[model samples]
Target: MKRILVPTDFSEHAEDALKAAAQIAKKNGAEIFLLHLLELPNQMNDAVTNGSSIPEVMLFIKKANEKLQKIKEQPHLQGITISTTVQFEKAFDGILSFNKKNKIDLIVMGSHGSSGIEEILIGSNTEKVVRLSDIPVLVIKKDLDTFNIKNIVFASDFSKEIKKPFLKMIEFAKIFDANLILVMICTPNSFKTTSMGEKTMKNFIADFEVNNYSMHIYNDSNIEKGILNFTNMVGADLIGLCTHGRTGLSHFFNGSISEDLVNHTIKPVITFKI
Candidate 1:
């Protein structure tokens, strides 16, 4: 974890993310890149390009900069290497672009938990980022005075594709020296016998030679519910999972458990793209 990208909308939720990022950065001795996007209208962008000097656009930029500076000066962020960028682009696009250009190791951002009609319409920038980001993304929902992870619930199918992200999850767990509860969710739709589940999980763990971990087969109606139920039952501090980074119609029809967890769960989630 060398570089962390935190995109903010100047909301309380965004501050929660910043505080979490600060803790992680301090732990890893990593730099924090704080980004705020200004989704300016086409006319405003043209005016700025032509040096027309739109007062409102300039004012927005100035205020965003001021806010960013204030956040950097916050007590929690002190002594951390913080870089701020106020960009003229959509939130999701700017975040991905920044990550690629900077080679960010992780993205720690906050979600405001959308649901029902609102989610159907506007969706969430945090969800989009989690769905698309190549690097690991940690989604924080609230303020964590001390971002400690003693137990991590990692839910997966124990499939071959999960190996890549599963390794990334291990690296994250090592940072906290956390105990990993590797779970395979067995819903009725995708039911597997206990013996089969245990054998598969054992095989998966064997490849990595992981330590300080336990395996379990959880049963629920759906994957999201199963993972959440298992995590809550075990009182896990963090939830780690892999996402296929699905989009468009595929994402709509099939949906994503990782993205759903990002939107619905209050627990801090770290998603790795598989």
Candidate 2:
């Protein structure tokens, strides 16, 4: 990774993500862009709409810059190259615009779980970025000091759609020198025989020339639960997923499986669009 973009709201969860990004930057010698979005209040928003005085908008950005300056003084960011910027936009829009203009190699952001109904109305900032980002996104839920990725559980259907993201996942796994385990989740509604499951897995691996990776079939009530159960069983350090699976729109109506995993799991998740 060359550059990491971390969007922060100055929340504890966002701070955790900043700390984790610092560690990664130290390891890879990458620069960190610590971004804070200055969302205006309704009155200021209406002022801008009516071409009123720019004092309110300017003041908000000034405060945001002051906040970032305090964060920049933290001891943990001493050795790493860091830059701070404040944008006058919503969190998601600011992140997307910055990523596009700056060419972010990866985005590391934090999520404080949201319910399905809540997500359908207004998705969490992290979830929105994951859905829209073209590059890989790493969602952090806990305060992790050392990101020692040992075993990565990549749960997918072994479909052609997974091939692209699988390549990116492989590169990420190699960064940590971790074992990449491929797992297929078989639910009651979509059960697959052992032979068929194994056959599909073999074909998937064969097409990619994947070696030195483990494969398995997990049976559970649903894909999300199956992935979590298997990860716990094997003590995997990370979870890899591809956004927008076979079902597409209908599947991600409230939130995609990848989004749900990010919302619920404490384990770090890496996702790429299908």
Candidate 3:
């Protein structure tokens, strides 16, 4: 990871993410891009639009720069070459544009930036960036400020088809020297044999030299709850997910475990497309 992008709103979650990003950058000799994207308020409405306030926009950007400066000045972040960037637009679009134009290796952003129904972490903006961006996204969930990422629980189905994205997850695990726990949650009413499930997971891990990893299988009625329970149980710092992009009824019913996990778990989640 030679280049890392961390999108911040100067929130606690973003700060935690910065800490994790800094640790990873320090270990791998990478440069940090601390980005603060302005969701330029729409001033089209006669009662609500402040969209054309160039001076106000600049002021916000300046304040964001000062915030990043303060973060860099902290003794914990010494020796790290941290840079800042601020853009005016929709939060998600700003990050996507910046990532592509700058050739960002990875995007680290908070889970919730602005309040909304989806303000589960950095809000819906973080999710959109994750969905739209080609680069991998690391989401630092709000309220996890300590950032002691000793373990990463990778929530996977152990799909038979292996792809290039798996390599990214492997690299991150290797980067942190974090333990990989491959967890599969099964339905309680389902009558599948336990051994069959274990075999699939074992084969998946076998592809990698994951001698340090372990697999856990459970009967879960609720995938989201299972993930939250497992995360807390194991003290996982991050939940790694491989989204297969299932849609329609499957998507609505099973939903996105990664998203649900992000909303429910206090720990951060690192997600990638399969």
Best by lDDT: 1
Better of 1 and 3 by lDDT: 1
lDDT of each: 0.81, 0.78, 0.69
Query: By lDDT, highest first, what's the ranking?
Result: 1, 2, 3
The residue ranges of model 2 lying beyond 4 angstroms of the native Cα positions read 42-55, 113-122, 209-212, 245-264
Q: List the residue pairs that clash in candidate 1.
A: none
Per-residue alpha-carbon lDDT of model 1 for 49-151, expressed as tens digits? 8988788998999999999999999988899999999998888899999999999999998766434312421456766777778899997766778899999
Cα shift from native, residue 206, model 1 (Å): 1.0
Instruction: Name model 1 segments beyond 4 Å from true.
Output: 113-122, 247-255, 258-264
Error of 2 at 240 (Å): 1.0
Query: In model 2, which residue pairs have backbone atoms overlapping below 3 Å?
Result: none
lDDT of 2 by residue, 104-203 (tens): 9889987663333235214566657776787888877678878788899988888876788788888777667789899988887778999999999899
Model 1 global lDDT (CA atoms, 0 to 1): 0.81
**Per-prediction TM-score:** 0.91, 0.86, 0.80
| Better candidate by lDDT, 2 or 3 | 2
lDDT per residue, candidate 3, 76-99, as tens digits? Answer: 678888887766666778888888
List, in order, the clash count of every candidate structure: 0, 0, 7
